[model samples]
Target: MVTRDRCRGALLGLAVGDAMGAPTEGMTPEAIHAAHGRVEGFLHTQASGTDDTEYAVLCAQGLLAHGRRLTSNDVAAVWTRAVLSQDGGFHGAGFSEMGAIANLRAGVAPPVSGNDNHESWSDGAAMRVAPIGVLCAGDPVEAARLAREDAQVSHAADGIYGAQAIAAAVARALVTDDHTEVIAAGLAAVPEDTWTARLLRQALDVASHAAGMAEAERELYRRIPLFHYPWPDSAPEAVALAFGLFAAAEGAFVPSVVSAVNIGRDSDTIAAMAGAMAGALHGETAIPRAWRTKVRQVSGVCVTATAGTDLVDLADALYEASQGNEEYENAT
Candidate 1:
């Protein structure tokens, strides 16, 4: 199922693990193992992708200019005409997109400007909800209700339930290849009395009873208390440390995106949401052709309409608009 080389390897493995964890975002996994002892590859040499691959290629070009009747004011007017009426602003964006661009430049519109006077919950809507998991690829609850209507606009309530649990685990990893049934369909699309679903169900039950990946990162840091937040970019700590490193790399794909770029704070949006769930559970020939020939295309340093955006030809036009929205919902 779900091919197109795993939808162009889940958007080129989320822009090659967001340009290999953009310079170790705010290092401190022991200062990224004393400054790069284990990044493994592609730390630089023109590595790019920032605002989490330009807000997931402007939400897959607004789900192909409005499909399945996309709204939330058409994703807040596609973030006010491709990033707040660009002019070399909004680069490397954060702080819930600078508090929804100061409440959409004070005109404040969109789920009330994503909670105006924002109290950020970070992970900036799970790093652009992976194009609503390629526009609801296999419909994990309509990709968690279009990722909570494009994450309220910027994020709120456990950061819009951590972008609806990584858009329902990349829409069940684009249709079953069973990584624990795609993390149990992204924890059954949220609401197990959240704190982002109890730290993603206690970090996928201690990464499903760890045995590897350094004993599942030391039994998920001795059962998650995460050193009282010294930055993991809280969308419930970067979506429970990207679903506990994709259940401690049981999903493989380069050991769950090189353990999300050596597990540093917000390391390129947790290695672009664990490289879009292990490139939608191992596709695009498991991404490694010299890092897909330096995964180029993005130039707008962080959302200037994603300057040249070509994330594997916009994920093959969002997998051909999710096969015309699953044949217009099976012809209504």
Candidate 2:
């Protein structure tokens, strides 16, 4: 039951959220308010997607090339050829990706490459995993498994768990309208004792009790204990915040993404994750026309090869690929 509308919504939502949130990425909620009151729409005249959108396209391409047979080695090979082989440095890429690239340059491989990287716990993997969910629609466990295959190339521990959670959530969302079920699928994908699980639960609790977006933001800031590190790209934090805001907005596309953007701290990634889930839940019609139009094509800022890539066409291609795989699996 994975429709093309929902697929389009998922990818377009990711791009819209990435572009809309880019301007206020590092600023606090108060700073965002001071700069621009409650960013319900695009900030700039011509909003452009950041690393989040490009990396997601990369993930989609990986899924397109390998389907359910995708492996960590396949992911590494894609990274080497599509990413590392390019002359220009990774524009606005995350620390974990940079570390993984360095490892690849040194002839090291995944699991080791990811485990040895210092920034393996960042949200890099989670940001680009929505495509796994798209390909594994209605199958959260399968989505989580595929997500791990991709995450192991550049992430470990909480990073992998966060990617699994988002992928599972999106997979569930693609088949069901129940936001609670989507959240449950995400939680089920991760271990109960892990930091990602704990934070996700805490974020949901905060979202459930809060009266409005403002109160939810404040409560999230108070309850979620961001690490003392200088950077604000922790996988657990970003994923938890995105899910919490999705809950707060009751899975509405615009509100979910806007809430994540307004909450600040890794805004682009958080908003992109929230937007992906919300878009899947509601379908393409739920997203505003203007936002959809703006995100139809990527800027290729991070991954230059993704420049001029039309997300609408990509989504259709992904849906077609998924159907082919499903047919193959049924016949087998």
Candidate 3:
């Protein structure tokens, strides 16, 4: 039951959220409030998505090219052609991706490329995994499996787990209106003993009791123990924060994405992930017309080849690919 609207919403919502959150990224919640005074909408007149949206487009292309048979090698091959061969440096790409690219340049393969990287626990994988969910709608297990295939190329452990969680959640959201159930599906995709799982549970617990987004932010900031690093791209923390905000907002598209943006700290990726879940739950109609229109075509600030790519067309192609996979699976 993966309708066209839901498919459009997932990709468009992710791009819009990434754009909306870009201005406030890396700032603290207090800093965001001090600067923007509660970001209710887009900060710039002509907003554009950053690396988050570009990487997502890359992922959608990968899925379309390989379908359900997508492997880590397939992902690496795509990256080699699309990412590594690009003329300039990967401008706004995340640390994990840069690490993987460096490894790939040295002829190292994935799982090893990801493992040898220093930022393997970053949220880079989760930021671009929503398409796997769109294709595997109502089948969280398949979504998680495919997400791992994509993630293992540049992430490991909690990073891969975070991608799996978001993919599984988006898949469940495509079929159910209950946000709690959607979150449960995501949790089920990963091991309970993992840091991602533990942080996710704690995030939800804090969000459940909070009065509003501000309170939830405070509680999450206090409760979650972040690594003593300069960057705030921890996969476990970002996924936990995104899902917690999604739960708090009860899966409302605008509110969930906006809250994640305002909460700051890797805001673009956090909002993008939340927006993907909410969009899957509610469909394209839930996204505001203005926001969706702004992100229809990516700016390709990170992945140059994805410039001018229309998310709507990609979404439709993904939906059709999903149908083809279903037909093939049935025939087999």
Candidate 4:
């Protein structure tokens, strides 16, 4: 079972990583270096998370509302009620989610809502699955199932598989300290022949064999072919890179998140995913106090109505819900 500290760490680490990486999201590694010269700490004066943390909170809300019985209809309904109906439009939200919302407004239902007819292989699904991993705890298979179902409202194919892989890794992390087991569980979440599976396997191999952090990062990024992809939002590539960072860090929270951030493109989301996995494995106590203190409730610049929502309390509520505790029965 996931301890309270781990649960808190999972969400807190996500927010911290997101906030830390937000300032460099779309920049290339060279651009990042030229601008900030290696992001060892927060770059923005008013740092906060973007769509990643907010969407994860939304996922937690949906899970709390329906428990293990959560479905595509449930996700779609929540999205329609909370997201599509919100003011300000879905700014900062990725193309996949934005496309899904457009479909929802057109009276489309899910998984059709998710099948937006565009390239549905973005990191959008993977970005929001840590809550499912928290709820499923030690059961990687259950985590993968719920992640796939949740993802069905916004992703498909490799996109869904990417979310599954992250969720499975988090689930394993919650119960054990062994990163190899975590990596294996991640691989087991999807079929072997999938693009996501291939990338994940390659990343794991690279992380295991590489001499050090720099070598692992270089080899893993090379395998992902980040420059070849028009956008670095490719789900397989993002998830694999996040996993490789976690492996290279050997489950240390800061190192994993920092590597993900400094590696560049789609930096925030990749770091967020890797942070969640490491945080789950190491527990909240393992996270640096300075970074934890720096993280705050979001202002909804991206996810409008979710502004000021307390991430720590929300995480606790999810953890409570996972254990069948009813303190938050009336909460989000």
Candidate 5:
């Protein structure tokens, strides 16, 4: 049988890491230090959520609330509205956050603009794709396909592709027995259509060698690390994130996430996206206890774990979704 615990672990692990990363969102390294005096571990309270995981949960809720299956149009409509709902407005990377917003800026009507760049790439989609993967665990292809549907509202190019990677990883995790093979397959599933894919592979190779967040970011960026432009890359921050997680895939889950978030410009999004990928590989129990203690995504009316879908329950649902009534739950 598929372990509900694993799925739960993956989902909660994701949410927890998302929350942990949230506190530092949009802060420069210096700013984060000034605010929290260098967060060595979880701070024991809600640091506030960002638009990353919030967008995903809200996007899914919007679909369920509307009682609609995912369509590019539907995804785009909800995504645009969601971005507009941002409290102070997105200060950075909104156009690149989801390619559709750029069209909106150019005066495309909401409904009409939804399909303009249906296939454009952005990382907005990649960060919140875990649930789709969790729910569609039975068929990896279907998982990837559904995840693309999830991302259709916002992500395109490498962003959409990154969602495909996470979904496929979680889907395979539901059905696999081997840990090494599971992560290996998860990395494999991330596509080679762009530089992000190439970097992911490079990261997987050097994941263990890096000493800390700064080094990992440099290795992932293939940059010569320095105080100035330590993480320069040709790829977008979202694209760099996909590989950053892969490069730092070893050791403690929370630390891995913290390191990735600490090193990069888009701290929360990178940690959140990478956390989902890592959680899918390792499960909830794999996450550190201290990080969970300090996160806000674990509690709140707005971000409640689905009533029957807390970490363990969510994992069980995916396992059942994949296995159906089969005793062994093995499709292969």
Candidate 6:
């Protein structure tokens, strides 16, 4: 059931939002409306991606190019190089980018932190995190573990939790074919203490009547309380976006992603996360054909809309990886 198309579908679904939302990443809901008007077109597609999904592709490209596997060292290298130029897919630098650049400059991978846990909760990790999820394949624990590594490369705390949630959800997609289960699995990944967790809790309470993204967005804004964060949602829009993605389950990929983007704070990253998750859940056909076709043609350097490697590839690889890993462990 996990076709090659679906493999790529998951990441591409994430990328569709990433590339489309790149231009609008930082703008507020009102600002987005004032500038873009109605927030309809592929407004974010004209340029490259921001830090979220771009870094995700970088890791994927690196893993694929270097061989079908990645070590922490390989991750550091790709992330290091990703920041040096736009090729890495980072739109702008964040804590992860800084650590990556620092490590590369030091001619080594960054040291893993210990003892005190870092508390950064940016959406960057969530934005660019689908590859980890796709590769996790039916294993939420492994997905969360991989997501944590991917998040800490720059983000900490909530960042790690967000990526874990998304990754676990994507990984779980390979197990059951149900959409509800997919959403449930994603929610289960994050803990109760974190912002992502709190947001999911709020969304779950309201998901039944929240109906369309518009109503869901308002409810989410009120509950998640983005006003408290210095950089808008500081938690980024991951929570609202996730809410919209779940609420907009009946809609197409573009609509789902757009809902996530327009719901306000962290629009781009939220859209990217939603897009990635929805894309994986629905597969390539889930995306709007016209939008995808346009994106493929308009893509900058690293991004691709179709005919590129995707989550399906990642999924199959994960299955193979699981077999190999199991064999290796048994041998040892």
Per-model TM-score on C-alpha atoms: 0.33, 0.96, 0.96, 0.96, 0.69, 0.78
Encode model 5's per-residue lDDT on 1-332: one tens digit a residue: 24665566566666665666656655666677777775655554535445555555654444343322556666656655655444444533434444566766566643345346643454566667666666666456776777767665555556666777666766666555444554554456566666567656656655557776566655654542222633322223454454455446553466657665555465666676567656665666777765543442333323233222233433454455445444322311
Worst 10 residues of 3 by lDDT: 323-332
Note the Cα lDDT for every prediction shown. 0.77, 0.88, 0.89, 0.85, 0.55, 0.60
Q: Which ranges of candidate 1 are over 4 A from the true structure?
A: 1-3, 8-28, 31-68, 73-109, 136-149, 156-230, 234-256, 259-261, 266-269, 272-274, 277-320, 325-332
- In candidate 4, stretches whose alpha carbon ends up further than 4 angstroms from where it belongs are none
Q: Write the per-residue lDDT of candidate 2 for residues 1-332, one digit (tens) a residue.
A: 67989988888888888899898888888898998987888978889998889988888878888899999888998888878877877778889989988998899998888999998989999999998888888999999999999999999999999999999999999999889999999999999999999999999999999999878878887777484768889999999999999998888898888888888899999999999999988888899999999989998988887889989988887777777744322211
Task: Single out the weakest 10-residue window by summed lDDT for candidate 5.
Answer: 300-309
Considering lDDT, which of the candidate structures 2 and 5 is the better prediction for this target? 2
Clashing pairs in 3: none
**Each prediction's number of clashing residue pairs:** 0, 0, 0, 0, 12, 11
Runs off by more than 4 Å, candidate 3: 225-227, 325-332
Q: Give the C-alpha lDDT of model 5.
A: 0.55
Stretches > 4 Å off in candidate 2: 225-227, 325-332
Better of 3 and 5 by lDDT: 3
RMSD of 2: 2.7
lDDT of 6 at 302: 38
Choose 4 or 6, whichever is better by lDDT. Answer: 4
Error of 5 at 32 (Å): 5.2
lDDT per residue (tens digit) for residues 17-132 in model 1 = 88898888777667888977888778678887788878877777777787657877788887888677777567667777878877987888777777763555777888878777
Models ranked on lDDT: 3, 2, 4, 1, 6, 5
lDDT of 4 by residue, 147-251 (tens): 988998988899899999988888888889887788888889988999988888888888989898888877876777568667888898889999988988888
